[model samples]
Target: MSSPQRSMIAKVDSALTRCLCVLIVWLISASIWLLGLLSLSDLTMRIFAYGEGWSDVSWAELSFMVIFAVLLWRHTYYCRYFAIGIWKGMGRLLAFQGTLACMGLVIAVFTVDVEQHLGASVGLLETGADPALELGELGFILLALYLAAPTSVAKRLSHSPVSNVESAHTTAEKEFTV
Candidate 1:
């Protein structure tokens, strides 16, 4: 293939990869949020004996989710596609959020049943609210961060000085060629 053809192909491939990564991350986060909401509802019903107990998730299920997150955390090769390969700084943020999510999941699983107790225990900390709820919330927040990190990095880099310079240079080169 000619140089331009090769570049076009590479750009297409990168775009496809970015789309795949975005879809995967978004879907996973959405699923987790849905499942967590369902699980919370089930637990509430089981404890309070009210409402529909749908989507009750067990400890094993949470463990599986943690495992999946850990695996996803390990596989960050697709991050390069974000912002036309300028999101290298986001790798650490992604890794940290993934780790935080995993930790929150484990804590949530351990205190799944006695969330009130967990809250009481941490009440002295004055952190506000139940510890279990906080942990669960943190997990979801981290997942959101993980989901948004790539796009945020891409956006930030797109307006970066380096990118502006590169864009200007490319435009000049094209004009000269024409």
Candidate 2:
């Protein structure tokens, strides 16, 4: 009701909103990474299931999957820092890589019959849920792309008010010097 109480409520509300946003971003990013991991496992299983041995498998594809999985995992871990405005340059680079990884995932999803692999692995031969699964994955991929975007999550959360004071001080210095 009072001014101070209103101000406190506003601060608490903003903090809660920020935390919720971060948690949502984390869930999305982590889910994407888990998809990558699942894909990698499927590939590994297929290699062992059909091939005479590991040597008979396609090394190139296997290696690519491994790299993709690692990138996704790392991106999932680092995105939290990125969201909080730490190591922005590294975050941008990782985000770009994450975008590329998502694209790679798109290709893999379409080309590799991921549903079949997933179904087989889980002992469900024909659930007929391919369309739904694909749509969900596509949605997640789009979310990943959104997370990778440069404009999103650009604002740094600074608790200190000194930055405002410092900027004003610099502006005053410039005006007096000129």
Candidate 3:
């Protein structure tokens, strides 16, 4: 194919890839938000009742989340598409994003069951006047974030370049022209 054809193909692929990446990014962001909400709910419930210690299981869960965050805290491959091209600025952006993700996880973990800082432990959308409604709020927030992440990303990146779908269509039409 000619260079224009090739450029067209590459740009189309890139645009599609960006759309997919945006989706994936939103998914990750949403998951993080959900986890935070879960922690918030747990914290709220345990507030007024008997003091529940961070048992072996809670600690285990915490440690696991902590470790998982640490493991995923990588930034060396953010802007790299298919591991082929590596731009300095893109790499830096990736690193920054990765770091931000890790930081978000850390913040969530620290405030998981800490009710004082966040007001209530449960959510406030509940029907009745529950003292610790923050948990419910947290759940809603978490769900909202996760669900909204993809939408937000898609909306943000909607202006991304159009892929070869149009070009392919044009090619097909021209092929039938003669």
Instruction: For candidate 3, report its TM-score.
Output: 0.27
Q: Which ranking of candidates, highest TM-score first?
A: 2, 1, 3
User: Could you tell me every candidate's TM-score relative to the true structure?
Assistant: 0.28, 0.35, 0.27
- Among all candidates shown, the one with the greatest TM-score: 2
> Hey, what RMSD does candidate 2 come out at?
10.1
The digit string of per-residue lDDT tens for model 1 on 37-141 reads 454344334333333343454554455457546644533544554443434434444445555555666776666546665554533335454546534553554
Please give me the total number of clashing residue pairs in predicted model 1.
0
Where model 1 places Cα greater than 4 Å from the true spot, the runs are 1-6, 49-104, 108-178
Candidates, ranked, lDDT: 2, 1, 3
lDDT of 3 at 59: 40
Per-candidate clashes come to: 0, 0, 13
User: Which consecutive 10 residues in model 2 have the weakest lDDT in total?
Assistant: 137-146
